[model samples]
Target: MDNLLVKTGSSLKTFFTELGGISIMVFKAFAAIRIRHNFIPQIIEQFILIGKKSLPLVVVTSAFMGLAIGVQVGFQMTGFTPHWIAGGMILRTILIDLGPITIGLVLSGRISAGIAAELGTMKVTEQVDALRSFAIDPIGYLVTPRLIAAIFSVPALLVFSNSIAILLSYVSCNMTIHITWNEFVQGMRYSFYVSDLMTSLIKSLVFGVVLISLGAYFGLNCQRGAKGVGSATTLAVVWASVSVFVLDYVISTIVFYA
Candidate 1:
């Protein structure tokens, strides 16, 4: 019983410690932007890497997601439910929930893992120390640009994902339930809310910040050699994914319920 209590206390300590570290890193990342000129090129590079390179995967994933949602919604529409409502349901689902959630989870895996691995490798190799030795602030040179790029690129990706998903959803609705384009558009127009769009964009921005901050924290604080890098990468992906869902719920609650 004593051992169990001690373990629980230790776990709580570690959790809060890590949380504090991540919070500090996020602050420093934003503050580091004052040195933006030094890292402007890196920002652009990361933008392309995070946004342009991720486009193909987003397209494919959004297409399938839309089709799946459309088909499922259509199937559920028995007799009482209006066929036109399917369009609004699909659009709302994609924009308000699925769109940002999907992008957040997907990019958390790819982006967070990659950032952790890259930075962990540098740490293990003492490259981060080398930056210090050269009087370069690693946070400024490394974390800030990635943070900036993610903030911009994530929303961009979400927009693209939402667009593609909605389009494919329309197509699927047409094929599966025979919803005409005009009917789909009308349904969407009626159900559309500016708040929903704002929620999506806010979620995307927060998700981006969360992913990069977690990734950088784990990577910078990595244990040791190759094994440490791998572990950090895994933790980054896991934590980033979990954080996305948590934040999504919190944001939704505050926006819609409150």
Candidate 2:
């Protein structure tokens, strides 16, 4: 029993220590931005990597999501409600809520996982050490760019995704339920507010930070060799996804009251 207790305590200690190290890395990523002119390229590169590259997936996924929601709402409103109202409500719920969250998840799979795998491989191959040898800060170069990308890209992706999703919703309604574009647009205007948009943007930012931080944390700490890189990559995605959920709840709580 004492041995088991000791092991448990040791595990908890390691967990917190890992968390602290990640926290410091995050702080450094933010701090590193103030040091130089390199930030502009980093920011631009990040915008492309995290946002531009993600557009196709975001658009395709969101469009389908919106379509599915429209269909489901139609079934739900079968007897009692007007087609236009149901279409509008679905569009509202999506733009105001699911749009950002879904985009964040898609990003976790594409952006976060890519960051982890790339960095983890670099670590195992001593590319990170190579950066250190040149007096280049590896964290500054690799980690900072990714952090910037994650921080900025999420909201952009959310906006892009949300817009596309709404477009799909409108079209679906028009085709199947005959909701006019004029009425659909009006419904969107009525149901969505600046506050809802703001709340979703906040959530996307939180998700972005969490995703990149976890990826960097795991990648930077990867053990020796190929297997270690793979393990780190896997852990990065898992932790990033879990962090997304936790942060989502925290943001929702704050938004609900704010």
Per-candidate Cα lDDT values, in order, are 0.91, 0.79
> Cα deviation in Å at residue 250, candidate 2?
1.6
- Write model 1 residue lDDT over 55-106, tens digit each, in one string: 9988899889998998888888777877778888888898889999999988
How many steric overlaps does candidate 1 have? 0
Q: Tens digit of lDDT per residue, candidate 2, span 138-233?
A: 788888887777777788888888777777777776666676777766766667667777888888888888888887878888898888888888
| Sliding window of 10 residues with minimal summed lDDT for model 2 | 79-88
Worst 10 residues of 1 by lDDT: 31-40
